[model samples]
Target: MPLTLPSFHSMQHQQDFFCLSPSDSTMTENDFFKIRPYHNTKKQMPVLAKSRRGMRPMRSSTTSTASQKNRKLRYYSTLPVSKPAITMNHSFHQQGPKKDFISLLPYEVASQIVSYLDLSSLCQASTVSRSWYSISRSNEIWRHLASRWSLNIPQHIYPHQLDWYHLYKQRHILNNRWENGRVATHYLMGHIDSVYCLQFDKQKIITGSRDRTIKFWDLSTYQCVQTLYGHEGSVLCLSYNDHIMVSGSSDTTLIVWNMKTLQPIMRLRGHSAGVLDVCFDDRFIISCSKDKTIRIWDINNGRLLRTIFAHQGPVNAIQLQGNKLVSASGDALIKMWDIMTGECLHKYAGHTRGLACVRYDGTKIVSGSNDKTIKVWDAESGYCLMSCEGHTDLVRTLSFDKDRIVSASYDQSIRVWDIKTGACLLNFQSGHTSWVFDVHFDSTRIVSASQDQRVLVMDFTTGLDTQFL
Candidate 1:
C-alpha cells in the first residue's frame, strides 16, 4: 500500500511511543524513519522516506529513547534543512562586501553605462546603493537619456533649478500617452473653409485656408490671435522662421511677411501656374508651382534669382536644406536641386503615382505619394531605402523629425510611423471628419488640418508643461 500521512494527533502519539521504545536491529532502513505530523497550516504533512539509522535519530532537548539509549525522534518536527537560516541572513555577514566599480567610474563613463538601462531598470538601480543613487540621478545621465530618446526636451531650462530626470519623466509620459491615444483634442475654429496648410512653434500656430486668409492662432488658448489677407485665391502652403514668413497660393504668387510685425514684406510673382509650396531660410525663399518650375528668390526682396524646369508635371511639394532643394512632383518623381546654381543633382523615382509631399533634411529625403506609400531615400546615392505603407488613399501631407514621420491621408486618417523601422506606430482617425490635408508634430502633440474645416490639435501633453515644445 502507498504510504499516507496520519492525523497530527495520531501521528504524534505513535512517534512519541516509537522513539521511546525503538531498538529494532532487523528493521530495514526504510522502516527506521517515521512520518510525523507538524503544526504548519499551509499544507498537510508529507510521507518522507526513512534514513538508514533507527527512528531517524534527531537532536532533542526534552526527550530521549529508553530502548535505544538516547536515540530520539522529534515528535513535533519542523521542515528539514541541510543548512541553517543563519548562513543566509540578509546582513550577508558571511560574505565580504562587493565593490561597486560601476559607481566609482568617472561621471562620463558611469553615465554611458547607465544609459544602457531602460527607465525602469534605472529607477530600480537608483535605490540599490548610495553610490548608485548618486550616479543614476546625475543630471548628465538624465540629459543623455533624454537626447538618446530623441525627445524635444527644452535646453537651458531653469539652469539653476533644472531637474533633467523629472523633465524626462514628464516628457516620456507625454510620448507614451501619444502612442496610446490619450490626448486632449481641441480645434482652432476661426477658419471658414478647409484648412490646407499649417506650421507651429512654441508660441503659436499659423494656418492657411480655402477662404484665402491666413490666421495665426495662440496655441495655449486655441484662439485666433491675428489674421492676414493678401492672397486672392486659396492659400496652399507656407513656411516660416523666427524673423520671416513665406506663403504660396493658388493666385500664382508668393508673399514674404515680416514676422515681427505680422505685415507684408514683399509680393513675389514668377510662376505661370498656381504656386503650390514655399520654404525659406536665412538666405533664400524657394517656391514650387503647378507650372512644373522651382523658383529661388531673394529673402529680402521679391527678385527671382533662378528658375529651374523641375519636373514633367506640377511640382506639388518642395523642402529646402542648406544648399539643396527636394521637390516631389505630379510626374511620380522626386528630384534634388542646387539652390545656388539651379542644377538638378539627382532624381528619385519609386512611387507608381504622383508624389504629394516631400521633406529633406540634407542627408535623407522622405516623400508621400498618391500611391499611398511613404518612401525614405538616401540623399547621397539617390537610392530608396525603405517604403512605409498603410494609408488606403493618397498620402497627401507629412512631416518628420529624427525619429517619427507623421503623415495625413485622403483616407481621413493620420498615421505616426517610426522613421528607421517603417513601423506604423499610431493611427489616429477620429480627429478629423473629412480628408486630412496637413499634419505636423513635435515631441508633445500632433496638429493636423482637414477638409472638415477645422484644425485639430491632439495634445499628448494635456496636463504637462509644454515649455520645451
Candidate 2:
C-alpha cells in the first residue's frame, strides 16, 4: 500500500470523487503524488518525495469536490441567518402593529393627573398634541377646576398668572360672550376718592364719594347724570327714602337731597364731630355721629326731635327697621333703641374691637367690626348668632341683599357670604388698590369702594374681572 496526492487537472464537468492519503511514494499509483496542471496534459505533476506505505487516493475527482465544499462554506459565512432575524428584517420592510399608550392608562388615573393643571395651562397644552387636546376639552376637567377656582376667585386668579396672548387669541372669536360666559358690557368710573355708598333707583345709580359729592349715574349711557354737591367734607354715609337721598358728612352735617332734582332741600347741623351714618323712616330721620349721640329729626320739617345719649363712644353706623333703630359704635357694642322713647332697648356684646357698620335685614342685624369679623344677631332679641371670620384686616362695612351678606375690609377685599350658613361664597378683590371702605350688592352685581380712589362694579355669576372707576 502507498499514498497518492490528488492531481490538479480538469475532469468531466460536475463530477467528483473521494481520496485519502497517509504517506508519499514515487512508483505505485498509491505511492505516487501527482498535482497535474488543469490546462496542459504534458506538464509534469508536482511530486510528493517521501516513502509511502498503507496510504491511498480514491480519485482526482475528489479535489474538485473539496473546492466546491470550500466555496459553499464561504458564501454561507457571509450571511449566517437565524429564524428571528429573517422574520424581523422582512417585517421591517412592511407594516406591523402600532403601540397605544392612552389605551394602556386607566381612565380614572388619567383624569386625576389632568385635574391639577390650571385652566390656562390646560388650554395651551391641548393644542400641542391630539391626545392632550381630547382630554383637556372634556367637561369633567373644566367643571372641576371651575368649581375649585371659583370658590375664591379673587385670591386664586392674578393678572400676572394669566397668559394674555394665548387667552386673547382664543377669546377673540367671542361676540360679547364666549362659551357660556358674558363679558363686561358697562363700566362706571367717575369718583375722586372711594365711592363709599351707591344706591340704584331703576335706571340711575347714585353714588356717594369721599370727595364730598353725590353723583347720579345714568345706567344706559354710562355717564354721570348729575353731580349733587352740598356736603362740606367727605361724605362718609348715605341713605335713601324713596324720593330723598340723605347724606352724612365728616363736617358734622346731614344734607337731604331731592332725588329727582339732585338738589339739597335741607342741611341739618347739630353733631359736634363727624356724622358717620344716617337713616330715615316715614316720619323720622335718625343720624349717628362720632359725637356719641343719636339724633332724631322730624323728616317733614327738618326739625331736631331729640338727641339721645345712647353710646359711650362714637356711633359709627345706624339702621332703621320697623319701630327699632339699630346702631353700632366705637364702644364695640350694638344697641337697639326705641324710636319714640329714645331709650336703649337691648345691647349685644362680643365684638373684639369697635363695630364699624351695622345693618338690618328685617329679621337679622348684621354688623362689621374693626376686629375683621361680621356678626349676625336676632334683630328683636339682640342675641348674637354667629361671628363669621375670614378677612385679614378690619371689616369696614356690612350690607345685605335678600339672602346674601356682603362685607368690605381694610384688607382690600370684599367677601360675599351665605347669610344662613355664614360660609363665604366669593371674594371681590377690586375697587381699591388700598383698603376697601365699603361693599354693597343689589340683585344684579356687587359694588365696592376703596381708599385707592375708585369704585368697582362686579358681575355676580361669572366671578371674572371687575370694572372700576
Task: Quantify all predictions' global Cα lDDT against the true fold.
Answer: 0.79, 0.67
Clashing pairs in 1: none
The Cα error of candidate 1 at residue 19, in Å, is 54
lDDT of 2: 0.67
Per-residue lDDT tens digits for candidate 1, residues 173-224, read 5665655556677889988899999999878999999999999999889999
- Top candidate when judged by TM-score against the true structure: 1
What lDDT does candidate 1 reach at residue 118?
61
lDDT of 1 at 11: 14
Error of 2 at 16 (Å): 99
lDDT digits (tens) for residues 187-257 of candidate 2:
47778776777666436677787888887777657688788788889888888856888998999999988
Q: Model 1: residues >4 Å from true position, as ranges?
A: 1-118, 125-144, 150-161
